[model samples]
Target: MTCKALREGGAQVLAWDDNPDTRINAQSDGVALTDLDRADWSEVRALIVSPGVPLTHPEPHRLVRLAREKNVPVIGDIELFAQAMAALPAERRPSIVGITGTNGKSTTTALIGHILKKAGRDVRVGGNIGEAILGLSPPRAKTVFVIELSSYQLDLVQTLRCDIAIWLNLTPDHLDRHGDMAGYKAAKFRIFSNQTSEDAAIVGVDDDHSAGVMTRLKASQRQSVVAVSSGRSLGHGVYALGGKVFDALGRSPRAILDLKEAVSLPGAHNAQNIAAAYAACIRLGLLPEGIADAIRSFPGLAHRLELVGTHKGVRYVNDSKATNAEATAKALASYNHIYWIAGGRKKEGGIGALAPFFPRIEKAYLIGEAADEFAATLSGTVPNEVAGTLETALDLAARDAAAGARDTPVILLSPACASFDQFRDFEHRGDMFRTLVRARIGNA
Candidate 1:
């Protein structure tokens, strides 16, 4: 996408990949593949590397180090888009809503985009979620870009200034890339860089780390801060308490929407996402009533708590986006009788933190590399079995859920670990689950 954008921008694009197959594919796609060893460094304007390519922690990528040695500016796609947006005239500059967090970033980004688009705004949503930032429609008058930025992309971006920057609760993620929590937090804080007092900064106060971030931003008093939460109430900002959505961003408090009526936006985690999105749309000049209506009509994202199908008295939810314990916790908390399928590449700290929600699980079917370890963790705590694969796990879970006494038994695939163990990625895993569930329960 970056290559295509560069070509469209009228630059002679030169591309190379570490993998020979990727290089061949790039060449096949009309990208100019260059042998870096023989290329002239003086002729290269800037090195636009992918966010996955390391820049600092665990030592920078060899190409990154080489670029530094050549005194070339190294940046990611977001930086390129930012530069392009900056080049536009002031009146034609599009507003940006940058969302960053360990979890729920994709959902929040999609929701904001959906709301803005439904309200008839020219909106383009892409960053770490759907499309590369540069691949989206170019900057124009009355346009808004709701981008989901990961820490890696944030680490590489410098000049991008968001009109509405949301720091949704931070957790320990991408530790290898950032080295530690402090480093990770520092990388995420870059999303707020270059913002003025006229802009708005929405911060989630649900977790201690994010609360601390909110504290610092408040002390600065440079940008308007909307401290959002799903668990508790604040003097000002947006939040949901006891299934009620509150709007105190304007301090003219009002109960906008009851979360009970919001069938798609389930769980407290989503509530936090809602609070942040509501604050952003309101700041962007959308009416409170309209924002709430759009949120209700939101079809929701693909893999995050998505109810793919329902079989004989059982509901199947595909939450493959729950790549860690923190994410899986949301899925577990959302339902009552959960026949949960969990396990993949077990993340650090395992599922120990999810002990509180064990009682909600009717039974757990584990799969992939972390199956045995997860089963051991669930031993004497929650009734669980090592089912070994998603197909088997879903089969067992659906059968057991259908026979269960509960009014609405839920077969949930909220793997609280990485998906690289048994599938290509989370999307592939979720897609397989949806396919299998549909196959098992035909026509329904």
Candidate 2:
């Protein structure tokens, strides 16, 4: 999409990918089949690398090394789009809201986009969430772009200053890509690295790492920072207190609406997501009443704590997007008693950090490549069985959850591992889970 957007902006675009099946290749003006070893690098203006393109961790891609050697500027799609948007007139240009964190980025981005659209604004949401940014039509006079940016995308951006910059919360994730914890945090911090005092910076002060990032941003003194908390009353930002959303910066942290009013938005993690979206909406000058209504009516995004259906008393949730341990931990925390279906191609650190939530699991049905390793980790801590595939896992989990003593029992497929082992991607895995759940539970 970035390449196509650049082409539409009247720049010559050349796209090269080792894989021929890439969607970007089809959208490009010209394709280069030449390998990094064989292609001449002197003619290119800038090399637009994918966020998935490794530049530092697990060894940099050959193309990146070639770019470095040839002195060609290596950049990502976000930077290119940023430059394109800057060339347009300020009023004609779209307002950008960039949301980043270890988790809940997609939900918050979708929520912000939903609220803006509900208030009758022209909005397009894509980037690290659903559609590619370039796939959407260019911004018009009233268009607002709600972008979900990953640390990788933020790392490549140079001039992408958002009107509203949000940092939901930071945890140890994508460490392999960023090299270390400091490097990972540094990438996330880049979301607000270029913002000035005129822009709004929303920070969630829930975890120590996020709090530390907020502290540094406060020290920088460039952008106006609004601190939100999930556990406490934030005196000058959006927060959840006594199940009601509140804007505390004004008189008395006034009540906006009760979270229960928003049926789709549940759990404490989602409350933080709601708070972030509300903060962004208020910063963008939307009325509180309108924003609250949008929050109440907006349907949640798929594959992240999504309620697929209820069979008997068991509620099946498809959270296959939780491909990392940290994300799965959040999903686990959302439910009190879960028949968890987890395991896949394991990342580093395994499920060790998820030990805190072990007691909540009624029984774990492991699947895919990481099954043995996950079962080993849960030994003595919780009961687990290796189900090998998602189908078996789902079958076992659903039956176990149905028979269990807890009311409102949950069958959660929140794999804390990547999906490459069994499926093409996370979405495919999530879709398959949802389909199987509906077929099994709906029939029963």
Best prediction by lDDT: 1
lDDT of 2: 0.87
Task: Look at candidate 1 and give me any clashing residue pairs.
Answer: none
Q: What is the lDDT of every predicted structure here? A: 0.91, 0.87
Off by over 4 Å in 1: none
List, in order, the clash count of every candidate structure.
0, 1
Best by TM-score: 1
Tens digits of per-residue lDDT for model 1 on 244-345?
999986647779999987789899999999999999999999999999999999998999999998767788999999999999998999999999999999
Q: Which parts of model 2 have CA positions greater than 4 angstroms off?
A: 20-36
User: Residue 275 in candidate 1 has what lDDT?
Assistant: 93
| lDDT by residue for model 2 (1-444), tens | 565577666876655677767645563645434455676667878888889999889888988888888898888888877887889887887889999999999999999999999999999999898788878777888788999999999878888989889999987788889999999988988888678888889999999998887888889898889988766897688888778888897868788889899888777888899999998999888999999999999899899988999878888999999988888888888887889999889988899999999999999999998999999999999999999999999888877877788988899999999999999988899999999988886577
